[model samples]
Target: MDAYYNCLGCMNRQVRVLTMDGQQHEGTIVKVDRNNVYLKKESNGRVQTSAFYPGYGYGNQILTLSLFTLLAIALI
Candidate 1:
């Protein structure tokens, strides 16, 4: 099965991804291409505030995972 094609159908949707290294990431799919899948990672309810700038919410983070490294991608 082509991981890229599978991920293409999941764009802009929340999903849980498991990589070949056994790491799990839950996020909203931001982009999918031939080589990678970009995810807007969900925060675990812990606000990430920078010390340099107080009271600033960094917001959700984006992660880039290789398409070949993805072991599983499930809709949440």
Candidate 2:
């Protein structure tokens, strides 16, 4: 999906910035929009939320079609 909708909410407050190479940055999903996902890194074993952005930062993180299906199902 070029844009993410309700992904942060589907994430159930947990969000991770994923890299194409499978590397991931774990954080709490604070907000979501068409552009970027905002995540606040886990600090002191507690998570925080941040503002949203336009796109992924690490690299071109493309979500496979199957992943999209999974997300859709999850959202429902």
Candidate 3:
């Protein structure tokens, strides 16, 4: 887990993270803590104009994953 602590320097950078269970997450690193890494998950859906706001798009969601569950992390 100490190795994952090095992710602190990757804050605000785009990354692709693979977990032990085979799940993959791609996003910008939002925050890294002692127990978890938070990612502002990128959305793959096509952009849609909001009904009320013509130019605004939906915001990406934040994902909280346990540092211990990570199998790999790569910068994209």
TM-score of each: 0.76, 0.42, 0.73
Highest lDDT model number: 1
Q: What tens-digit string does per-residue lDDT give for candidate 1 at 1-76?
A: 4899889999999999999999898877777778888777746764222122223235544577889999999999
TM-score for model 2? 0.42
lDDT of 3: 0.71
| Model 2 Cα lDDT, one tens digit per residue, 1-76 | 5436555445545554554455455654545555555455665865333332446454323232223322222221
Worst window of 10 by summed lDDT in candidate 3: 47-56
Reference-based lDDT, each prediction: 0.76, 0.44, 0.71
**What is the C-alpha local distance difference test score of candidate 1?**
0.76
Model 2 / residue 25 / CA error / Å: 1.0
Worst 10 residues of 2 by lDDT: 67-76
Q: Candidate 1's error at 25, in angstroms?
A: 0.4
Deviating ranges (above 4 Å) for candidate 1: 46-60
lDDT of 3 by residue, 29-51 (tens): 77777888877765676322112
Top of the candidates by TM-score? 1
**Span of 10 residues, lowest total lDDT, candidate 1:** 47-56
Arranged by lDDT with the best first, the candidates are 1, 3, 2
Higher-ranked by TM-score: 2 or 3: 3
Per-candidate total of colliding backbone pairs: 0, 2, 0
